[model samples]
Target: MTWDAVIVGSGFGGAMVAHRLISAGARVLMIERGDWVTRGEAAWRPEASFELTPSYARDIPYRCDRGGHGTTIGAVACVGGPSVYYGCVSFRFRELDFVGDADVVADSGAAWPYRYDEIEPFYGEAEGLLGISGDDAGDPTAPRRSRPFPFPPGELAPISMRVVETAVDMGLSPFHLPLAINHTASAARQKCVACRTCDTYACAIEAKNDVATMMIRPLVERGMTLWTNTVALRLEAEGTAVRRLVVHRRDSGEELAVEAERFVLAAGALGSPHLVLASKLDELSPARAAVGRYLMRHDNAMIFGVFPQRPDPTRRFHKQVALHDWYFGDPGAAEGAHLTKLGGVQQMMTPPKELVRAHLPLGTKTLLGGFTEQLTGLLCIAEDQPRKDNGVSVDWSIRDGYGLPQLVIDTSYTARDDLAVDVLARRARQILSNMGALLSYTHRVKTFSHAVGTLRMGTDPETSPLDGDCRFRGVENLWITDGSALPMSAGVNPSLTIAANALRAAAAMVAR
Candidate 1:
C-alpha cells in the first residue's frame, strides 16, 4: 500500500509531522524501530523490577557496540522514542541562537534559513499541544506567548528551594521551569506523583507528556498507521524524487518495501544521517556534501554542592525554577548567558551512596550527617560548537539484526566546546557559593541527551544536506524534521525547537 507520507521515526519530530499531516487529510505511515509500551506498562517500579537491570531501562534502546569513543550513548527503540524517557524540560532557542558567529557555523555552513520570529507561533502551538506547565510572567527572557501555560507551575521540592534562594541571593532571576507534563489529574492521564526516578527512568504515572501520550496515541486514534519494531534500511529514488523505502522487522527480520509520495526522516541526529549515508545516497546526491559533517551535542555538566544540614532530597524534589541571568549575557547584547529554573536543579540529585561518597571524603558517616540539610545544585548545559571532526558515519562492515549497516558515531568535544562547558561550570559553582551552600563536588563535563547538527539546514545546498525548508538538497518529496536539521547546537534543550520546526516544515510541505 502506498502512503501520502512515510515518517522514519516516531519521536517528537516525526510525531509532530504525522499529527499535522494526518489532520490535513494526508495518510501517514510512521515506522518506528522499537516496541510500543502502553501507559500501564511503560515503566517498572523498583518493587516490580530490580533497579539497574536491563529490563528496568525502559523507553531507551540498548547500544550493541562501544567503539574507541568511551561513551555509552543509547537511543530509544520505542514508539515515542527518547521523548518517552526525557526530563520533559521543553524550551525554545533564544533569538541569537538562530544567527550566531560561532566558528562551527562558519566552518560547517550558513545560519538557519528561518529566524526566531518565523517559528515563534509554532513554538506556542507546540507548547499547547504538549500541555506545558509554567508561569511565563516569571521568566523575562521567555519568548512572548499568545496564551498562558495550560497548568500552574509544579511546586518546589525542599532541595530546589535552597538552590532558588542561593540563585536569588546571587542576583539571578529564577523562574518556574516549563515542563511538558500533564499537571492535572485528568481522565486520560494521571497527575505527576513526584517520582524521583526521572531522567533515565520512564514516568509510570503518564504525567510526563511524552510523544506517545500526547501526540501518537491521539493521532493513532484518528486513524494514523503506526508500524512499531520496523526499521527502514534505505530509500529508493527516481530522478529527483523518493519513490519507496526498504524496511525490515527489527525482531522477525521480515522484509517489506513501502512506497510513499513524500518521505520524512526523523530518525534523530545520529540515526538519520547514518541511514542516508548507508543508502549510498551520497553518490546519488553528492552536492549535499555536509550530510554527516558538522555534528554537535550540548556539552553539559552537573554541579553538586552539599550543605551542613540534612536536606530531605525526597522524590518530591522540585523540578521547576530556572535561572536565565546567564542564558544571554548583557541586555541589548545579541547573546546573553542564562540558566533554567532552580527547582529543576534538584533533578540532578546524586544517588544516595554516590552522593555520600562524593561529599564525605573524610568518611561516609560525616556525609550522612550533612545529608539532613538541603544540598543545593544546578546543571550547566552550554552550547557546543559544531565540529567536522565529530560526526556520524556509516560503518557498512558492521551490520545490525536486519543486515543494514550500523551507525558509527565518532563524536568528541572541541577545545572551544570544552571551554564553554568549563565557563558554565565555574559560573554555577560561584552562584551556589554565593547562596551559602558549602561546595561539595562538581561532576565532570558530560554530554546532555540533546544532540543535533549532523545534517544541518542552510540556504546553500552545496554546504548543507537540507535546505531552509528541511527538504534534502536535490531530492524533492524528501525532508528531515528532527534535531539533525539543526544548524547550531543551542544551549537550551532541543525538544521544543524540534517540534516547532517540524510544524513549520509540515506547513511548508502542505503549501507545496
Candidate 2:
C-alpha cells in the first residue's frame, strides 16, 4: 500500500505532521525505531530511568568526540521520543530569537527564513494540542500571545515557592514554567499526581501529555498506520523525488521497502543527517556543504544549592519557576562580551538518591546518600551559536546490529558558548545563595537533549539545505519538519518550537 505520507520518526515533528495529515483524510504511516513504553509500577521506579535501564535505549551508540575526549552514548529511543522523558517545559521562542546575531551570522550561516509572527497561530495550536498549562504573567521576554494557554497552571509546591520568593526578593521576576502535563481532572485523561519521578521517568498513569499520549495515540485511532520497532535504513530516490524508504523490522527481522507519495524526515538532528548522508542524498542537494553543518545544542549546566536543612522534606514536585532577567543579555555585563544573547534559568529538582550514590566515592557513598534531601538545583540554558566545523558524520568501519554504519558526532563548545553558560551559572548560584544556601556547586550537562540546526532552512539555497517552507532544496516530495530544520536555537526549551514548525510545514505540504 502506498501511503499518502510516510513519516520517518514519531516525535514532535513526525507526530504533529501525522496528526495534521491524518485528520485531513490522508493515509499516513508513522515509523518509530523504538517500541511503546510499558507504563506500570516499573515506570515510576528508580531502576527504570534513562541511565539505569536499557528498555527504551537506542541499540546503536553514537560515537562522540568533545572536550578532547571520546565517548559513546545511546539516545533515548521510544515511540514518543525524548518528549516522554522531558521535563515538559513548553516555551515559544522570543520574537527576537528569530533574528540572528550579527556575529553568529558571520561565523555561521544562521538565519531564520520567516519571522515569529508567521508561526504564532501554529504555536497556539500546538499548545492546545499538548494541553499546556501556565501563566506567563511574569515572563517579560515572552512573545505576544494570540490566546491564553489551554489550562491554567496548578498550585505551586512548597519547595517551588521558596525559589519564587527568593527570586522576587532579588528583584527578579520569575514565573511558572509552561508545562505540558494533564493537570485538570477529567474522565478523558488522568491528572498529574505531582510526583518527584517526573523529568526522567515516564508517567505510569499517563498523566504527562507527551507525543505518544496526546498525538500518536489519537493519530492511530484516526486510521494512521503506526509502526514501532521499525528502523528506517535510507531513502531511495530516483531523479528529483524519493521513490521509497527501506526499513528493517526488528520483530520480524525482515527488510522491506515502503512507498509513499510524500516523505517527511523527522528522525531528529543526528538521526536525520545520518540517514541522509548514508543514502548519499547530499549529492543531490544544492547546498551540499550545508547538508550536515552548523550543529547547535544550547550550552547547559546544573547549579546545586547545598543547604543546612532538607529543602524538600517530603520531596514533592518542584520543577517550576523560570528566570528570564538575563535572557536577552546581562544588564551589568561589559560591552563586547559573550553575556550578550544569554539564556534563561529554571528551577530543577534534586537528583534521586541512587543517582547521587552512583558517582560518589565508595567510602563516602553511603554517608553522602542522605545529603540528597538537602539539595535543590537550578538549570542554566545558555544560547549557543552554530559553527561550521561541528556536525555529524557516519563511520563506515563500525556497524550496528542492523548492519548500518554507526553515527559519528564531532561537536564542541566555543569560548563564547562557555562564557555565556558561565554567566547564567553565576546568576543561578546567586539565586540559590539568596535562599539561605550554605554553598553551591556546578555540574555541566553533556547531553544532546536540545539538538538542532543540521539541515537548516533559509532563504539562500547556497547556505541552507532546506527551503523557506522546509522542503529539501532539490527533492520535490521531501520535507524536513524536525528540529534539524531550525536555523537558530533560542534560550528556552525547543520542544514547542519544533511542534509549531511541524504544524506549519504540514499545512504547506498539504497545500502543495
Candidate 3:
C-alpha cells in the first residue's frame, strides 16, 4: 500500500507530525514498534494487575546498558514511547538555547538552524493541543502565550509548597510547573487524580496527555492507520530519495515492505540514530560527520533538604513547581544551572533491613524520620555539551527480538558538563541553607533519562544528518522529528520543543 507519509514511532514527535499531516489531507501510516494498550488497559489504577512493578517497568524499555561513569541510558519501545511513562513536565527551551554560547557553539560543531522565535507559534499550538495546565498570570519570565492554559495548574502538595516558600525566602523565583496534564476533566480527556504513580509509572487516570490519549486517539478517529508491534528494519533508498521501508512484526515474525512518499523518523534520540546506522546509509548519504556522535543526556543531581517542619511527601502528583532562576547564568560565565522539585522526592523509609544496614550511614535509622521533616528538594538539570567521544553505536553482535542490531550507547559527561552540575548543586545548597533547613543530603550526579542529540540538526549537511527543517540531507523524503534532531541539550526538558518542532516539520512537508 502507498502512503502519503509514513511516521516511524508514535511518540510525541511522530504523533504531532502524523496529526498535522492528516489534518492537511495527507494519508498517514504510523508504524510503532510496541504493542498498543486499549484505553481501559492504559489506565493507571493501583488495583490493576500490572501496576507498574520493576519487571513490568522493564517491559516498557526503562533499562539502559550502562557504559563507563555509571551513566545508564535507555529508551521506551511502546506505542506512545517515553511520553507514556514520563513525568509530563513540559518546558520550551529559551531563545539563548537555540543560538547557543559562543564557546559552546564554536565547539558544538553544529547549531540549530532556526531560533526560538521561529518556533514560538508552534509551541503555543502544541501547548493548546496537549492541554497544558499552568498559570500565566504572574510569570513574567514565561514566553508570551497565544492563549491561556486549558486548565489551571495542579494544586501544590505540601512538599512542593514548602519548596516554593523556601525558594521564595531565598530570593529565587518558583512557578507552577507547566505540565502536559489535564488538571480537570475536559471534553477531550479526563483530569488527573493526583496519583503518586507518575515518573516511572503510567497515568491511571488518562490525564497525563501522552500521545496514546491525546494525539493518536484523535488521529485514529480521523481514520489514520497505525501498525503496532511492527519495527522498521531499514530504509530502501534510490539515490537521494527513500522508496520503501522493510518492517518486521514482532508477534508474527513476518517481514513486510511498504512504500511511502515521505517518512518521518521519531524513533527517539538513541533509537533513531541506531536505525540509521543499521541501515548503512552513511556511505550513500554521508551528509553529516556526526550521525550517532555527540549523544547528550542531562547531567542531573538531586539535593534533598530536611527542615524542622513535617511536610507530607506522599501526594500522588507529577510536578508542581520549578526553579528557573539559573536557566541563564551570568552573561559570559562558564557555569549555568536550573532546579525543579521532584514529586516523589523522599527518603526511602522501609528498605529491607539487610540492605538498609549495608548502605545506611552508621546508626542512621534514627536519622530517617528527621530526614523526612522537610522534604523539599531540587533536581539540578544542567546542559551537556556535545562531545565526539560520547555517542550511541549499534552492537552488531547483539540483536534484539526483531533481528535488528541493538543500540549500544557509549556515552559519558565531560568535565565541563560536570562543572555545570556542580554550579547548580552549589546554588541549591546555598538556597537550602538560606531556608534554615537543619539537615540535607545530596545524591551523586547521574545522567537523566532525557536523551538527545544522537542525530543533530545543522546548517551544513557535512556536520549534521538533518537540516533546519529536520529533513535528512541526502534522503529527500526522510526526516527526523524527535529529540535526536536536537543539536544541543538545553538545560530544560525537550518535550514541548519536540512537539513544536514536529509540527513545524510536518507543515513544511505538507507544503512540499
Candidate 4:
C-alpha cells in the first residue's frame, strides 16, 4: 500500500517523525537498514560488542590526512541506531551555535541559514518527549529552557561528586550531567538500573530510553509498520520528487519497490548522502556541489584523572558530573592564563574491566586494572568546526558485500579544529590538576559518534542541500531530519539537536 510518508532509519530523527506523523493520523511506514539489537545478557557483553555481536555496525574504512591516522569508523546500524547505546548526554546547543561563528564562517564560508530562536521551542518539546532529566544550574551558558527537564536530576557517585567539588572550588561551573533516562514514576519509563554498561553497551533490561525501547514500539502499536533488516538501495526519483524506493531485504536478499507520496530521509549524515549520491540526485540538484559537503564531527578526547581514593566498582552510576565553564572561546584574561572557547566537558562511566582488557596491552592493562578503582574520566565534546572539504562520498573504487560502492568518509580537519582540541584537552588537564589528581592524560580521536552536516539545512540552494524545514532543496517530497541537517555541530552532543529539528520537520510534514 502506498503510505502518506515513508521514513527511513529508525534512529532519533526517524523515530520522532514516525511518532508525530502517526499521531497526526497519517499512514506512515518506516524502513530500517539494521534489525533490532540484543535484548538480554548479550547487551552487557563489552568485549564482543563490536568484535562478535551482529550489531550490524558499518565498518567503513576512513583516513585522516594530516595526523596520518586511519581506521574503520564503526557507526552502529541497528534499528535504533547509536541512540540505543549512547551516554545519554542530551544538551541543547548554545544560541550562538545556531547563529554561526563569525570567525569560522568567514574562513570556511559555512553558516546556518536559520538561528536558535526558530528552533528553541522544538528543543523543549524534544526534551519533554524523551524524558530528559538534569540540573541546569551549573551551566550558565546553556540556552534558556522553555520548561524544566521532564524528571529530577540523577544522583552522582562519590568519585564523580568528589571531582565536582574540586571543580567548583576551582571556580568552574559543574553540575549533574543531563541524561535521557526514566528517573521518576511520573515519566513512565522502564526502571533504570543505572549500570556501568550504558555508554557504549545496549540496555540489558530495555530501560535506557533509546528510540527502539521508548518510541518505536509505541508507534508500531499505533499503526506504524516498521520494516527492519531492510537496506535502502536507491531511490526512484522523478523530475522533482521521490517516486518510490528500491530496497533490498537482508534476510532473504529479495528486492522490493515501495511507493510513498512523501519521504523523510533520516538515514544519518553518512548514510543519507550515500542514498542521494547513489540516486544520482547530485546530477539533478541545483546544490550538487554541496550534497555531501561541510561535514563536522567534534574532535573528542577523554581525560582520565587518577585520584588516591578507590571508587566502588559495584556501584553503577559514575557519569554524573558535568562542567560547561567554557562554552565559547575564553575572552582576554591574564597573559599567562590559558584560553578556551572550544567545547563542553562531562563525566563518563569508568571503563569496565571487560572493555579495558580487550583494548589495552597486557602489561598496561594489568597495571591499569590494579588501579581501576582510582581512575575517573572526563569527556571533551569539542566543537570541531565545519569545513566544506570534509565529507562523505561514494567510493566507486571499492564495493561492499551488498555490491555497492562502500561509503567513504574523508575527514581532513582544519587547523582551527586542532586548536579547539588542544585548548579543550589542556583545560581538562588543568581541572584535574586543581582537583589534586595524581596524574591526568588525554586520548584524542575523530569519533564517528557525533558527526553532523553533509545534507545541511539552509535557505540558499547553492550552499545547502536542504531548506530550513529539512526538505531537500530541489526535491518536493524529500525531507531529512538527522545530523545531516545540522549546518554546524556545537560543543554539545548532536542527538538532541537532531531530534528537535526532526520534531519541527514532522510538524511541517503533517501541516501539508
Candidate that would win on TM-score:
2
User: lDDT values of the candidates?
Assistant: 0.72, 0.87, 0.71, 0.78
Question: Candidate 4 on 1-512: residue-level lDDT in tens?
Answer: 89898988999999999888988988998999888886888788666454345674554433333322345554578878888878788888888787776655656556676678888899888888787888787677878877888888777777677788888788878887788877654454557777777887788877777888778888888999999988887888888888998888878989999999999888888789988887887777788899888888887888877778755445677778778776676553323124344778888778776676555556677877666667778888778767777887787787766656667677776776767666666778888777667997565755566778999888778888888788887789999888999988888888998999999888988887
Tens-place lDDT per residue, model 3, 1-512, is 79998999899889999988888988889998777554454454443222233212332232345543333333466768778767687777776677776544447686888988889899888988888887745443466566677778878776566667877776767787778877777685677777655554567667788878788878998989999888888888888788988998768989998999998889888668877888876665566468788887777777766667644446535257777665655333344432221111111111222322333456664565334434555677777778877787777776766667766667666666676667777777766667666766765544435778888888877888888899887787899999888888777778888899989988888887
Error of 3 at 106 (Å): 4.3
Per-residue lDDT of 40-71 in model 2, one digit per residue for the tens? 78888877676676545658778887631238
Judge candidate 1 at residue 386 and give its lDDT: 75
For model 1, residues 1-512, the per-residue Cα lDDT tens digits are 88999999999889989988998999999998777654454363433222343322333322323322234455556778888767788877777677764453546555789888999889988988898887857565677666677777888886677667877776767787778877688677688877665554567777888888889989999989998878788898888788999998757767889999999999988778877887777665545567787777777777766655544436464556676665544232222223221111223543344333433436554654345345645777767677666777776676765666766666667665665566666667776677566765665543325778888888776777888888888788889999999988777778999999999999899889
Q: Rank the candidates by TM-score, best first.
A: 2, 4, 1, 3
List where candidate 3 sits over 4 angstroms from the true fold.
37-74, 136-141, 186-188, 307-310, 313-318, 330-376, 433-437, 444-448
Worst 10 residues of 3 by lDDT: 341-350
Please give the lDDT score for candidate 4.
Answer: 0.78
| Better by TM-score, candidate 3 or 1 | 1
How high is each candidate's TM-score?
A: 0.87, 0.97, 0.86, 0.93
For model 4 the local lDDT of residue 230 reads: 89
- TM value for model 4: 0.93
The whole-model C-alpha lDDT of candidate 1 against the native structure comes to 0.72
**Better candidate number, 1 or 4, judged by TM-score:** 4
Tell me the spans in candidate 4 whose CA falls farther than 4 Å from its real position: 48-52, 58-69, 185-189, 312-314, 332-340, 357-370
